[model samples]
Target chain A: MSAAAAKAKRAVRRPVSIASFAQSENVRRDDQHNEVEMLMPVVAEVFANIGITKNDIDFICSGSSDYLIGGPFSFVTALDAVGVWPPMPESHTEMDGAWALYEAWVLLQEGEIDAALVYSFGRSSPGNLNEILALQLDPYYLAPLWPDPVSVAALQARALIDAGKGSEEDFAAIASRSRKDALSNPKAQVAHDIPVETLLRDEYVVSPLRRHTLPPITDGAAAMVLAAGDKAREWSDKPVWITGFDHRIETHSLGGRDLTSSPSTAKAADVAGVADGPIDVAELHAPFAHQEIILKEALGLDDGVTINPSGGALAANPIMSAGLIRIGEAAARIASGQAARAVAHATSGPCLQQNLVCVLEGE
Target chain B: MSGQTTAEDLGPVTTLATPIRLDFEFTPGVAQSRFLRGLEKGRFVGQRCPTCGKVYVPSRGSCPTDGVPTTEDVDLANVGTVTTYCVVNVPFAGQSIEIPYICAQVLLDGADISFMGLIQQIPTDEIRMGLRVEAVWVEPEELTPSLASVRYFRPSGEPDADYETYKDYL
Candidate 1:
């Protein structure tokens, strides 16, 4: 390749830093407040952490799902929490808040906006989440059958076992370690330090996967502030720079792809430069215990990397906000001088069909 | 391309209908809980946003403009001005109201936001913007923690409100 063309392809974009992060206490049911009330404190805390106000933000973006709330235009009402008076530029995504963060990152890369606010909220307790999640499947072929999320994850677990890649004991170990780590996380909804042997003794919710392997249904919200270049330096003393970020998705048809492996995650890891340096900490948004094993393999993390230091989605999976919380958890560690470099991962769709990987560093 | 067949050559089209039924129970939040309880007491309770000073009926919990919780409770009069309205002539399944009824956006006195209310005890053609109306409550014995406590609204026999009074609500 010509030097000019190669240089053009290798061009690096402006860096965006995660200046601040905050999240609501993950719980089974927050009966006292609605979506707006749930997000108000989180949004306020995120801005307060950075010593900034809504007027300082150039753009606002949020992530949420209307299906979880049983209403259309749900995010429109959520905008009330951001105090959008004076008419600010804003956008929203129906997917996870991590994708909303990605949108804000892309806008910052344009070098126009100095700072942006990203937030997301979900309340999964008011409805039958298993039945609601089934709606995300193919309406004609899969949804009509009403296969709940646990059963789908069970199928993936069974596939992994059949492929001789892992066992049920491995799944229990992941659960044990995650919940134990969650003991320090005051925001986590489920936290316990039960032994793997005790977890294995429990009855299976579905064949080859026990109740310990599944994630808890949670109601929560999270917010983060992203500032570019000098603005980042002004906000945070230890800014967690987003050095590389990318996301990829595989085919929607579950039967068409290998359930035992995650190709999309591996591809995203490559694009996000996961192996560029030693990873001190990693927060993987794997809702199920076994999926963490699959993601570890996809991201090529070795035994030295500390995984799910905040207990991860298995401890508090709040649907739309869980993925964003993973990004926040990883950045918080780096910002606190606990880690120099980290990797945060988020997944969407059934069986980890879609994935996003972000590499963060404190410089 | 020669293997392609026309629609007429195909025998028939097949389609499947799957009916999905989901049940959910929602708990009214802090602001809504108070609003509903006030309705049970035959009172019209509204909350005012501290930042914008806009009063909202039935308390939206938060102000859409300022994104702050409406803190101060404002007790509004039963009478209101019709900012805009629609005559529902067509019927649908499970509709409680009869045909050709006037459903209007009622801007309550001392409140900035408008709420949907049923206009009754007057001809549909007479229900226009700036028409003053008052709530017609069900008997005290039938009162409940719901908007249904007010059967409907009727002409208050007072002078019509000037259009300028509620034009902003429209």
Candidate 2:
């Protein structure tokens, strides 16, 4: 293991495991419900899966963005779905749900809370997501130019091609494999069994990125229950322990960073001890097809490893919740005895500027 | 060597102004849709939480206290008590009302929550907590599925309500 990985392992405090996971059906639009309505069922199911109730949880954290709904404090209203009566201790982050899970994990390490709930929701159908996402860039430089997500990802794809790291056919192959694998995931929004050659023939949304390379604009919510130590063991017969967790971020100035590679993901993987053991499955949150290739290289996974068994983000990318869903998907496999060890990865910002890596094992 | 930049050596730092416009179609969930439909019929409708029995105006579909849907609809009186208020004196980009107007939280009778509304027909100095007010409706032709149907709230000329009546709302 790397020196950094050894140091991270030494910092471990309490063992935390995922007790349960649940998600709403990813769809192009959920006109029938608002953010609160969308999360109600998901929160219920996550708790129910563990045969527990909200009364048993010690803390609640959620992730969401008000920009998606064009309102301030959107999460405050979403909290109603959890019925936080008696005023439960709660927190929120304007980031992907994976960060919220990280916060819960930190709290669990303190040994004060035995269990916590983490959730996130996003409704991209309410507004034009491309324009909304551009606002997340540096307001003075990138936002003024309105560089949408697609164009930014295309730049990364072009960089990969220019650096001889990957080719257009490789991008198509990633997309084809992901969507085809999603056929088994009932909650997935996009699933198909098409050939890679057929996808390559599609018109390009941006140069170096075809329409199939981009993720669908989906509205969805996801929730998970996390318990530490003995509580975790009591909750599930086969607990998926979070052995290692770490995250890193890069500068927002896209031009200053290398676009063809993901240094942040590699650093996080090292700190998370991703290479310490043999990985049976990996669920990478790569919204763009080319991004999956970059992440695979950064994580240093071998051909023998199974990737995106739940189709990954290329199948159902629901903005804020997609990253956390990766962790849940990986943990579910471990809990079901489908895999002994897994690596779940989540990325945020443009060109994978921010990344979180989690290592899980069945016990 | 001393490191410093003289005024003459420094050039002007360029800056640019940009406007961001994002359009959205907000779907008010089941409770809010029902409330809007009630407004079209000149009624104040709210939903009562089954667990807590708290009536939320502009029903938010779920009771935040219990984490359950508020299924029981309750019609509230247009008359309410002003729990608190503020006088807006500054102008903003989208200021529709004139400055120095009273914007108050009105706790409609039978509703557990208070909603923000404009206070009119009373002198600014006369607007106070616990003051009774009634809704002022626009012409029926202008009525739509919006809270705008009620133009504002005016003093009802009744005696101020007891503090106990709106203390919880504040």
lDDT of 1 by residue, A55-96 (tens): 899999999998887877989988988888889989999989
Estimated TM-score for each candidate: 0.95, 0.93
Query: DockQ (Cα-based) per candidate?
Result: 0.56, 0.67
Name the candidate that leads on TM-score. 1
Residues B1-170 of candidate 1: C-alpha lDDT, one tens digit per residue:
58889887876768878788776667577888888888898879999999889888877688878777787888999999999999999999999888999999988899898899999999988888999999999899999999999999999999999987987888
Model 2 stretches astray by more than 4 angstroms = A1-11, B1-13, B87-95, B98-100, B157-159
Q: Considering summed lDDT, which 10 consecutive residues are worst modelled in model 2 chain A?
A: A3-12
Place model 1 in a CAPRI quality band: medium
lDDT by residue (B45-164, candidate 2, tens digit) is 999999889999987788888888888999999899999999988889999998789999999999999999999988898889999999998888888889999999999988999998
Model 1 per-residue lDDT at B134: 96
Question: What C-alpha RMSD separates each model from the true structure?
Answer: 4.2, 4.3
On residues A1-363, what C-alpha lDDT tens digit does candidate 2 reach at each position?
777768757466888999999999999999888889899989989988878888999999999999999998999989989988678889998899999999999999999899999999999999998899899899998999999999999999999999999999999999999999999999899999999889989998999899999999899999999998788989988888998899999999999999888899999998888888899999999999999888999999999999999999989999899999999999989888999999999988989999999999997
Return the lDDT, model 1, position A124: 94
Residue A67, candidate 2: alpha-carbon lDDT: 94
Reference-based lDDT, each prediction: 0.90, 0.92
